[model samples]
Target: MPAFDLPRRLVAEALGTCLLVATVVGSGVMADTLTDDTALALLGNTLATGAILVVLITVFGPMSGAHFNPAVSLVFALKRDLPRRDLGFYVAAQIAGGIAGTMAAHLMFDLPVIEVSLKARTGGSQWFSEWVATFGLVGVILAGLRFDGKAIPWLVGLYITAAYWFTASTSFANPAVALARSLTNTFSGIRPLDLPGFVIAELLGALCALALMGWLLRQPANNTYSAARHS
Candidate 1:
């Protein structure tokens, strides 16, 4: 079957991103409330987020590469891989998805619209942390694409798992997630004031990944083009 068109892809990104943010952030808040210890909550949150991503990628990756993050799509565009015309569509979808997801989470969690708990950057080292976190995330995606993308889904899970701990900002590098998280002050909330900095950092990270992907994807003789054919 033919791949989904640009508009369809955007819709998928929007819906998928919304779900992703809701699950991740909601789990975090839920973890805080469980009678169980914080560790258990954290574990539950991580697993929930990871599992959802795997399913989302499997379901939507083929249609739109499941690029639930605007940074991811922009990176692909920078690489000349994505159709330039569709860039805006994908971004719009992701933004819409992010907001919608937060709205759903608010209702599900019984929290007001202003209480969404999103992960995000703060002052001081938090700025640098966002950049690094985004860099790592985009790197993972770009590198995965260079391969067969067979392990990408699994890798994404592992990546987020590690990112949750290692990065100072708790690795909330997803722009869609960030936007959705801003809607609430619950476990997933990231300060609205902090968003611009995060977005700038995320865009830079994606750009860096694009440069790396471009350089690495250069096939030698007989190697031909892998991504070209796939695209």
Candidate 2:
């Protein structure tokens, strides 16, 4: 059972996601405005995202496990760590909070609150990148939980920081974040038309991670022959 009740947990999820998306979008906007070099702007955006993730997870992990992504929530539900009954509620909260975060960023930048993104981010390579990014993210999370739970924040933050540079899609591994980014026509935005492909790839990648990590993390049975020989 969770230390906090469902309502409080939901609040934590919503608030954490809200702040996370705000950082993502806001940082991208600020970086874009400050520099014309795409790589430098992306570096700035990545740093803020990775930094905020560490802070958000540390603050909210105890309350709601700090799953600000639907793919993450779904993976936990599949692992039976999170209640299946609450998965929908958690996803809803995450998506809502994510959209709100985009709007908040827009308001801060004096832009339209819900401008649909026209940034083209669709392609086979892009979809493949999403899969690879999400797969690594879920794998890292599960492995961190199995070994060093306390280090999960840093693990995830660093993984994403690296993934942003390594992946072709800039690693929009979170479905909620992908959807929210679709509503913004800023530096971080993705076209609404490209949303489904990213979301589907992310979900598939997460499930694949769950399957592989589930088997990999299980304890191996003792070998009777080896024990007998030692004896």
lDDT of 2 at 139: 99
lDDT of 1 by residue, 92-188 (tens): 8888888888788778888776563345457757767777778888888878877868778877878887777776777777777787788877765
Best candidate (score: lDDT)? 2
- The lDDT, on a scale of 0 to 1, for candidate 1 is 0.78
Give the clashing residue pairs of candidate 2, or none.
Answer: none
TM-score of each: 0.87, 0.97
Q: Point out where model 2 deviates above 4 Å.
A: 223-231
Candidate 1 wrong stretches, greater than 4 Å: 35-40, 116-120, 221-231
- RMSD list, candidates in order: 5.1, 1.6
